[model samples]
Target: MNELLTKLSECIEFGKINMASPYPPNMKGQEGADEITRKALEEGVNPQDILSLGLMPGMERIGVKFRENKVFVPQVLMSAKAMSTAMLHLKPHFLSGAAKQKGTFIIGTVLGDLHDIGKNLVGMMVEGNGYKVIDLGTDVNSEKFIDAAKENPDAVIGLSALLTTTMVNMEKIARDIKEAVPGTLVTIGGAPVNNDFCARIGADHYSPDPQGVVEFLNTKFA
Candidate 1:
């Protein structure tokens, strides 16, 4: 709500990484998320406020834009970059218990699926929304997902698959997690996936875009 936090939010929304990055011409040469976040910390702004008030709003805006088709992958990736740059300063606070995360989210592309753009975007958006993301990367198997769930009992598991062939893997993984760790939440998404597929696979939730995932998690944790 303050000036510095407002500027930080604007920088994140506009994809301004620093004073030198020129991806968004209107914000060129202006102090960006990196600088403003660091300065905010130096000036004693609460790190939680920087995240909740500054970064989350920016990410939420772009997320809504993405869902409405007002923005595309490249633009969303840029905002994610700015968010990541700013998070560098806040990570320490999160680590030291000075700031709190909403929950843990374990995500991966189902086995035999090498695509990551969708998974990565979801992870970034979830992280921006205050969840700690444990990315298992692409081509992940059921055992790995089960192991992660076992370790983080309360964490939500997210499965992604771009290929229709690989989408079947999600069903197996979801069943594996439910059998191994009952009550664990599993959400699925990708080009070939839909709400019907999610229901068929016994997964808990499904969404077409990253924002939908964020909203699902928020409701789960709310």
Candidate 2:
């Protein structure tokens, strides 16, 4: 069972979605995350154990690789795809209340920023790490964020921006959230953002990558 879990993690980390998948060339034609996850459940492995031992660890490894530049966007996207495939099995357990999530994460790309790849990546990573992610998609304004926060009071918020001009909207949204919900934790990210800008705007955190956001959430919620 442990061996199956380990193999599942490897499949997800390396982007092997299934037996016929040719990705990562070396892993082609082997049982991938899709097959291995089903096998684990059939073998009577606990869903929680499979999630903690298989999927989450694999995502954490790929996330660290991304942070260190050992991997790039395409690789991470593939990994996220594999992870999402595995999550299909786990989602039922989560919804049935047999599994509990760590927390809630509300995320969006700030207004005027139609870019969603970065925001989507962060949301996927956070969700893979056991948080329920409420994605607001791209071009979200302060009021939408505020409304989501009101709907999920304990949720942490994340903001994404891809352009220098659009980063100003992130600042405005952050300010609005903070003003309306005094203790809300707001995190900012994207190509044009930095720790300095986050501080200047009174946001709670700044991360350069999806992994950085995961780490910040872990630390704060730990």
Local accuracy of candidate 1 as per-residue lDDT tens digits, 51-135: 9999999989888988999988888888999999999999999999998888999999999999999999999999988899999
Q: What is the TM-score of each candidate against the true structure?
A: 0.98, 0.96
- Stretches of model 2 off by over 4 angstroms after superposition: none
For candidate 2, list the clashing residue pairs, or say none.
Answer: none
- Candidate 1 segments whose C-alpha is farther than 4 A from its true place: none
Clashing pairs in 1: none
Number of the predicted model whose TM-score against the real structure is largest: 1
lDDT of 2 by residue, 1-222 (tens): 499999988887888888887898999779888888999888888888888889888999999998899998899888888888988888898899877778899999999989999899899889877788999999999999999999999789999999999988888999999999889999999999898998999998999999888899988777
